[model samples]
Target: MVSSTAQPPATKRLAGRTALVTGGSRGIGRAIAERLGREGARVGVHFGGDATAAKDTATAIEAAGGTAFTVQARLGKAGDAEGLWSAFDAQADGLDILVNNAGVNGGQVRPAEVTPEAFDHLFAVNTKAPFFITQQGLSRLRDGGRIINVSSGLTRGGAAPDLLAYAMTKGAIDVFTMTLAKELGARAITVNAVAPGVVDTDMNADWLRASAEAQAGVSAASPLGRVGVPDDIAGVAAFLASEDSRWVTGQWIDATGGALF
Candidate 1:
């Protein structure tokens, strides 16, 4: 007779898959990397200059019964994309998921204050890097794989003018997502963007945690009545990376907790 004590099987939606997450050492990238690991994906936790943090993220993934490894390459520089992929290929034979989550904010500078150098740097890291990185990865990314880009709600408007250049970069990503989705559809690959509003991460801690009033102000803007956390966006990324989102290609998923409304 079969025993009645049989437990339910564990959930590992991404088992036998491999993923590479840029900037996976901290903030939203870390959260996405960890989540993907938890789902049974062997994660490449990529960092720019923070080896320790990348190691920590990989360690956390392993501690949670998942596989992870750290890779480093400072983005926005020449040869950065190739370097990142070389490091990735050394660990994994091919990739199934690619999360382009690394970027810079260009400080709160407005149009007049924006320098030529600042503009170029912003586009290099935020737009050009992802474009080249994806181009390079296409050969390594297997058929039916997923490419999820981290975008910004600022692209939808209502954000401060200070974020103009930054938003422009994300807007380009939006277009890239749609067009690339069409190009890769024959291969069954899916491309999409995840746009998040102001989130409570190290990136925003300086201002979001400046005062109770400041925190409250941001929370009030969202119907959810709280600032979004990295995990909130991570959940959406995980979904996009999973088989569940097979039919959801070329879309901009709003992970902003109704802030845009």
Candidate 2:
């Protein structure tokens, strides 16, 4: 007999939809792709140079009874968006959700230590790629599609001075989210940004994984009393991709565990 508290088998909320998540080979991108796949969307897990991790993410999605395929394209270069969409078109007809989750942290370059080349590359991958990717993808993205841009809490200020350039890119992304939402509203599509704080990922391994004291310090920065995980951000993306967020757009949803406050 079914227990009163036991829920029914999960329902596929995104059945028959198609989603493409860049940098989906690991970390938050991986979690987002897997979550979307579990909700029944055929996921395109895009990776750069990491075929093994991409395959692993796809395998995990399939193992969980979802359909997924890997797409490879190195962002931050010329024609990167075209290459990505060409690969995407080979597998799916159109897009229902586009998660621009790929980016670089620009290392630890302060204002005095920053180089022009480094700054250019940071914008190329973090800002320029997503801008054009979405531009070209507008035709393939069906009316009412969801476009989720992964921003950062650093844009809100109060972060390290060395992250200045990185924060600037995210600031641009926030502006992109607002303007695109207005432009795409006519088609019922939603454009929004999710700004996550210091998440526990390979990107921050030098500090977060260094020692217990460092871990405690990072965790204490958040009111939640713990480091943010990839899944913590993925849960927010899933909500934005669903019908429930149809009424939400042109906004930056801070997933910073109250660090911004």
How many clashes (backbone N, Cα, C below 3 Å) per candidate? Answer: 0, 0
TM-score for each prediction?
0.95, 0.95
The TM-score of candidate 2 is: 0.95
lDDT of each: 0.90, 0.90
C-alpha lDDT of residue 165 in model 1? 87
The weakest ten consecutive residues by lDDT in model 2 span 1-10
RMSD of each: 6.1, 4.4
lDDT string, candidate 2, 1-261, tens digits: 111122123358889899999999998899899889888889999998999999999999999899999999999999999999999999999999999999999788788998999999999999999999999999999998999999999888455899998899989999999999999999999999999998888998887778788778767777778888887888899989999899999999999888877
In angstroms, the error of model 2 at 137 is 0.5
lDDT of 1: 0.90
Give the per-residue lDDT of model 1 (tens digit) for 164-254.
8889999999999999999999999999999999888787877776778877887887887888888788889999999999999999998
The true-versus-predicted C-alpha distance at residue 205 of model 2, in Å, is 0.9
